[model samples]
Target: MDPPLSFTVPQEDFLLFHQVDRDLYKILVTELSRDPSESMRLLAMWLWLEKVGFHNVVKNIMSLPIILINEIADETMLCLTCLTNNSNTSLTTIMLSSEANDIPLLQSVMENEISLKFFRQNCMEAIHGVEKTRKEVCMRAFGDIMQRAMMRNIAERMVENNNFLFGSTGPINLQFGSVGIAGALGQQHSNNNGGRGGIIPADERTLFVTFSKGYRVEEWEVREFFTMAYGDCIETLFMQETQPNEQPLFGRIIFHKVSTIDMILKGASKVKFSINRKHVWVRKFVPKRTNTDKVILPGETSGFGFGITS
Candidate 1:
């Protein structure tokens, strides 16, 4: 029986065999075997070898069994022809057109995580003989493959935070009241409870405002003014009315950042700024006790210091 083919071909050369002809095949094989560790460096060397006259090196390398040589050479030639004809073909088309045994090798090249320099230097060099537009299309295909590989790697590393709301420190023990009967009664007697465990505390970023007498607070006007003053940091702004058929006596403003509350309070007091030309007092909101009486009597204030009657 003929001696088995002694040399194991590099994966890249196997994928790009069509690009190698008899005149340049020897140089291509030599370059691919230069440094076993650097795949991309070897690829660059293969692309640099120009097609010249036949040499003794080519004869020696082709001394392998006729059957094996013809198999690889034929596959390479067919792949090269397909690529040269359809330079702008998709990667899938390139892979599908290749011989069945070579499919895995072609897939490996398409999925290889090489740098942009590899595509620009080696990949572009392989298609140097093609038209400029066709060359660009080929480079773009290679670039798309690299980009997809990078995105997939990034996505794999990104672990979803299951406890994002509570945070990674673990679930917080938010106690409604202390443990025992006293705690239960304390919670029950607390007017802020509203028949629940405890009153929902006001967000630190929110501000409670009491408008000056004879000033009718408009929700849109307040929102527009605060939005202009604070830019996008003002998340929410709305007027609060306690009595029916009456104008809004107060308003609430919630900021995107809690740190901005102190800054705004200090600045508002210093400037003596008012919303809609009326004196407006602003302070951090404090959760209030729930009242049984739904309606605010004409002259009574709702403990927030804002009177219904001017």
Candidate 2:
């Protein structure tokens, strides 16, 4: 066992391309078994690099120093190949630029195609392997890679898909249970069902539902519509219209307003309602105990996924 490197190396380049320099790899492997102190220290540094979009920052740390070097060589070759293929179009542009402003043209057209591919390939592998991570240490490293990968993939796909729905839709949409029922009507309803057992109060129930096409609902008729839908008044129904919020559950929902109906009627076809707000938080009177048995947790339901509220 050898001593570990004293200082941490920033892996911005390696993170994007998992290309650990030869000297760096040697240090990681030598420190891995010799002394856990140095190994852990360097490991922390490596993990930080991974989180910040440095893919395969530990590429040099393998079964052995020699094997590590061999893997780097293999990866370098693969990356070079990917770069070479990608460069063909740029190379053609370069050749055409001889009669034009070659400097600017070259700068704009040429990039390290091989390095980019190598980084993407290795980084994606590490990211996808996140499911195998058991420890928090490993999880952080994998998380960084995955975040970068997803961002890149989504950005690239957006460009490729050419989904330019600008101004055509608002960034967010808002919805809420109808508040048309006055306090008097609400009290009357409660009085009528006062002592009825199992009759949930009108204000204590909320429905997680979508609005009709062409509108973002602000005030709904509790007595006529939602009362029947929820079967009672409830506080706080996590309603998601358009698409469900995926993380950090319990936030306002934002959507666009595609259109509005003075009176929503049935038989609306292919109606488009643009999102008006990104998130809308609506408060309601929910019963003491909400039902979780019917609400499936994420990963438990086939397509519904999990929900803390559920």
Candidate 3:
């Protein structure tokens, strides 16, 4: 193993396409391995890059050495290719002009968790195969990546918690709980049932279900509806409607097991339950991107073989 670089790394073009950059790869492995939340770190770093639009900043190489580097072989552009061979996403962009509102990155790529995870895993693997380092900045950058990642995780969790509606009136949503009972009703129901017996609460055990083109769905029927159609695959602990007692079509459900939702959906985004000649859909809620036509680059729909759904 080469000794860690004590001083600043020179602005040398090391990341070249069709070539392995050993030092950079090692840095990715050591830092990512040392940190338990490596996945989050990778996610946060990429999200930040996406927010700022990486291609725009790469014109100034040192601007984002962690992502795009102005390395030797490609003098005209910075290197953004994934280190590992599996990734189809090219880190760099073609004809990247400084002035542009559009990110040009495939929205589908960003939205699909699997694609992003695969890309990050590839980068880490190529990095794992590497031996050691040649730059102080690279080490510092790695630390920064973890810091931002951890912070992002904290922020995401904090935001999802039901603190905001603690003292105020709010609509019941997946973030809240099961059945049309939101604040006081849910507690009352649990008390009436002698507490949530044999029920477990986990973040992974929650699923957002929506009913479309169906009769006004009632919160009371959610459990039975899923049970009859899905064959009681798992015990449903509770349900809370997004709109309480207004015949709301969507709600959040709590299952006894974390895998219950997946087992029911069977890899599909939605399950169309035929109820009274109506269509009821339950899916993993993916927030819709507004003004998608402007954000997603044109003529870039070819790389969406990863089953990315809206």
Candidate 4:
């Protein structure tokens, strides 16, 4: 298996817009005294629309003013918070909202195994008439691939430790095809602990929080994540969650793009071993505690991508 490539986005942008959406929903509905059961049902269905393979339903009913029904900021935040905070149920809500709007975010899932490429490709076909929508969908698909790779990487690490509790073998055992990032992670709840605390030391304890068996690392694109930089750097394919300080608490990637196969061939290129090279093709990062800021040294990356010999 090859390494996964990830994309980094400004965390503030996502959290901020989500807040606005939450406020909007709260203000519109709280005053109308709408049917509580009806509103709950709508919210549930909306989540399924994005997280589950129910995009058709979402496309059909998304036009409804579910949020506009309540206009109170507090109310909106409450609803949004509920969906965002509760992983088991709320993951669908987060996925739905993000998918409906952000094409890049949606694309991150394409790298995961849960969904066949057909759905995204169909979306491209359907939206080809609209240039703007087409571009958006394409970007979303790309982002989904990146995110899926990251999720799979994290899941693989956890599965090795038998850290996840929801599934005895592993969360990847269950197949809930087409669930978005949050939904996938949510389904694979850990028995030991929840949140990002269960990630391996190499991953800096930040959990991908998704369940999928997409961690095949030998592919070219997957190799790109490791070759682009030799130190801690953000991925271009998926967004990582941040702490309150907005610093990434999880592992960062360093990539170096290898143009000539010779660069890879001449280097010591064995997995799990280190070789000294002026340059290397790929390296699985291992963070050291020496620096206040985590940075994988050039020598370290060269050491890891150390298997290929001339």
Candidate with the greatest TM-score versus the true structure: 1
- Runs in model 2 deviating more than 4 A are 1-10, 14-225, 229-310
The deviation in Å at residue 277 for candidate 2 is: 23
Each candidate's lDDT (Cα)? 0.39, 0.30, 0.36, 0.29
Residue-pair clashes, model 3: 8
> Compared with the true structure, what per-residue lDDT tens digits does model 3 show for residues 164-252?
64632232243344444233221223322224443333334556554441266555466666677565543333222233444443445
Q: Is candidate 3 or candidate 4 better by lDDT?
A: 3
Regions more than 4 Å wrong, model 3: 1-201, 230-245, 285-310
Ranking by lDDT: 1, 3, 2, 4
TM-score of each: 0.28, 0.17, 0.27, 0.16
- Scored against the true structure, residue 274 in model 2 reaches a CA lDDT of 23
TM-score of 1: 0.28
The ten-residue window of minimal lDDT in model 1 covers: 31-40
The alpha-carbon lDDT assigned to residue 42 of candidate 3 equals 37
Q: Mind sharing the TM-score for model 4?
A: 0.16
What root-mean-square deviation over C-alphas does model 4 reach? Answer: 23.1
Model 3 TM-score is: 0.27
- Candidate 2 lDDT for residue 187: 24
Please write out the lDDT profile of model 1 over residues 1-310, one tens digit for every residue.
2232212555455335433332233222232121111222222222322221113222332433222222223333334444445455553354443232232212112223222223233444445533331232223323333344446434423422333444433221121222342332212233432333442233445686555434666677767777788666665564554466665545567665654676677744322346767655566654322221122221233443343221
RMSD of each: 29.0, 22.4, 17.3, 23.1
